[model samples]
Target: MPFVVPRSPELPAATWGSYGMTTLAVVPLIWRRRAPVAVLAAIVLIGGVYKVALDGPGQPLPYAGLIAFYTVALQCAPRVRVAVGLATVAAVALSVGWKTGTARELLFTLFVSAAAYALGRLQYTRQAYTEAVEARAAELERANRIEAEQAAARERARIAREMHDILSHAVSIMIVQAEAGPVAVRRAPERAEAAFEAIAETGRDAMAQLRAMLGVLRTAEASPRSPQPGVAELRELLERVRASGPRVSYERTGSVRELPAALEATVHRVVQEALTNVVKHAGASAVDVRLEYGAESLTVTVTDDGRGPGGSSSGGHGLIGIRERAAAHGGTAQTGPGPDGRGYAVRVVLVTSPQEVGT
Candidate 1:
């Protein structure tokens, strides 16, 4: 008989199947963030025993053990992290030590534990930085939206003020001149024709100014020149109102100095709105207009002796608009019965020194 060496006992079919199953068993550890401590514990208990029995001490399943350790380190709270880390280190060390019975087995286990901790810290830091960047970007977008809305609101206010200034003054004069033209025609034909002509001229001038202002508003591009009205235009404003029915007198006090474009326009508008109300509401024969310029402010007062239309002092949208204009400029307006108990008086005072406007 040929000398046949006794064949080493072959692995049983059941034992081989169990070993294959054990290799795949650690894969679920990757989902440790969803169930950190539980996954970690399960992986260490099952895989630690399997590796000791299968591969004897020094080597464990490479990716599976590393992933479980890293997940526990990153996802668990500090106290839980410490507990999981110690448990994993001891389990791995004992598994290897039982098989190899050597110090080198423990050293290899320690090295893997250290690498897992470092990787976990890196992942945690990366997540924190990403969250912070997202928060900052959201805040900036909200601020930008608020600023854009505010800018649009300011533009609307500017357009309203312009309309009030040009239309009110023009229309008031038209009403008065139209009313006076026929009266003059009966007594003085020459004066009547002049009044009619003034009416036409005022209408044409108002239309021109309105068209210019509206054009500036409609066009996206800058105008050939600025469309702002200043104190220099006050003379023309008064002349138009004078052409209306009320006998008007204008007096200026203090230094007749140049004012800011916006302030000048606002003052002009205040006076115009006041006189318009006078023409419409006050059944007076004469009106007095006063402009006072001081070191720090401009003041305007329009008074009439005629009885006002019997109603609440709240004239209409016109009065509300005047108040809004004054408030917008950090100023104030008051309209009530005249001081002498005769008619209505509208007074506006505007603070006008070097300061930011329309912001």
Candidate 2:
């Protein structure tokens, strides 16, 4: 607050003028944030005038100059700060004459002015650093939350696919067996007994698979233990369909080799879904299925002369499901007319090697 070590006596004749000058310099500080540089400039100019016009030589001291220096230090950039601080020091030093013995006051002014600038600079730097750290923490928290949501979505999709595959295939066969039970019972009890047994088997299989999936959701520690359906189980799937309806024939073009579990499952699902559509939508009496294995990939095609409008095939989620499975494995599925142009056909091609879809 005191720039001079020993205070200078106030000029009695100009006491009111001195009070006016101090008020003009310090009061503008309330609006410093809006016009910081302007306020500092006004105060500095007024301090110089107060020194030369009112106080006279050998009596110069910073009544409000110290406050101005600190405000400028915090608000201005580095270069402007240096200019304002140095100019302030020089203003105080040059105001006093060399003949006067006020060397102590000059030295005190230099130390106080430099100290004010340094303190203000320190406050600015600390505040800036704190804000940067808080902003970085907030960004990291947002990224982690987004990643958690994505993981949850993927899990839900997996469960949906599992339920669809298990229930749709098993339920389709069971429904056919159930409907024929009454008719077969009237003709021959022997055939009706076999159909009843088949219905029970399919229902039991569906229940077991459902339990496995429910276990996974019950707890992370209790995961799905049963082996999932794959290409190896295609025979069972085809046999089950044969017992139901829509005669399906299967043929292999190349040697069958071991493949990824997910890839095998994708193949099985595509064919199973295709055949299910044949049983439900297609009025065709027979369906043809083929699996072609190559060095780089595998291809499967299912065709049937189903009696339906052309739009039903693509308008449903069935085609989308087939395409998603193929594309997930870096492959594709296409649907159009059959080889004979009399029915709907679905052909799927899958690359042997796994490729990240969106990485």
Candidate 3:
């Protein structure tokens, strides 16, 4: 293809040499990103040679030079860019003087070069901003995923504690009643019927609580909406233990006011766990449950006239769950021999105010 430009006495005609020079000037652009300054230098040198030696038809635009300059502006350090820019300005001035010797052409060429440089810098800024935004988004996604996993773990622990307390207590009571049922049948038929009835009642209660929990897990529409066992349910819980042949007593101190539902539920669970330990480990005949409400705390104490803290009840999941529950509520749990070291006692102090509870 022929190079086309207006025929002027000063402008040389298009030649095969001019086309070859143009191709050479553009070829170096392939390595522009890796060695931008070198690429620009090559283009300038080729263009200068084509101008002075061949005096070929002038390009409408210095496309090769502009592209190389843009790459340099984008990829080079500030010191290199400044040094190259000054050299380019001197070259532009000399080229214009040697060609048309006109200020208008020189200004136009400078403006075009500056625009290319500006565009290169603008592109660099935009890319940097985009990368920063993407990095931040990734960090947030990781944080959210971690939080979700932690929440899932906490929920699983809670479910395990609930199931253990419910099933363990229910099964222990039923076992005791079932064992007594045969003995009572051989002695008093009336007591035998009561023991059997107690077993059935305990089983039904456990099933109801378990079903309620599983219903929520299954996303069932008809899931029982009843709140967890709270203070109002403590009496019934004591009665169940009483049926298993233990003399259980309940006492309250301080201002007996309604507490938060969560706190009350914890209270209920703590008492149940303690009584279970007593029934399972302690061979005591009598157990006492006391609730003492303080200014900003509620203390639950379960003391049994058992054989002291030994066996699985000393450091079991039951005790661990109690400690976890207390810590969650910004409270504490203490266990050891009861007063005078006669039996075992588990006491948990729980924060009552909602604001005081830990997350």
| lDDT scores in order | 0.74, 0.76, 0.88
Query: Which regions in candidate 1 have their CA more than 4 angstroms from the true location?
Result: 1-19, 52-60, 99-108, 222-225, 309-314, 355-359
Candidates by TM-score, descending order: 3, 1, 2
Please give the clash total of every predicted structure, in order: 1, 0, 0
Relative to the unseen true structure, what is the C-alpha lDDT of residue 16 in candidate 2, on a scale of 0 to 100? 57
* Cα distance off (Å), candidate 3, residue 165: 1.3
Return whichever of 2 and 3 wins on TM-score. Answer: 3
Candidate 2 accuracy as TM-score: 0.75
Give one digit per residue, the lDDT tens place, for model 3 in 218-263: 8846455569899999999999999889899999999999988888
- Model 3 stretches astray by more than 4 angstroms: 1-11, 58-60, 220-225, 312-315
Off by over 4 Å in 2: 1-35, 38-74, 77-132, 220-226, 308-315, 354-359
Residue-wise C-alpha lDDT for candidate 2, range 1-359, written one tens digit per residue: 23335345773443556666666667777877677667777877876777657753333346456666777887788888777767776666775443353988778768888887887788888889998999998998999999989988877876787787778778877888898899999997897898888889889988988988898788758454567788888888888777776688898888678888878888998998887777666666778889998777899998887764462273256667788889878898988878667788889998884444232
As for candidate 1, its clashing pairs are 284-306
- What is the TM-score of each predicted model, taking all chains together? 0.83, 0.75, 0.90
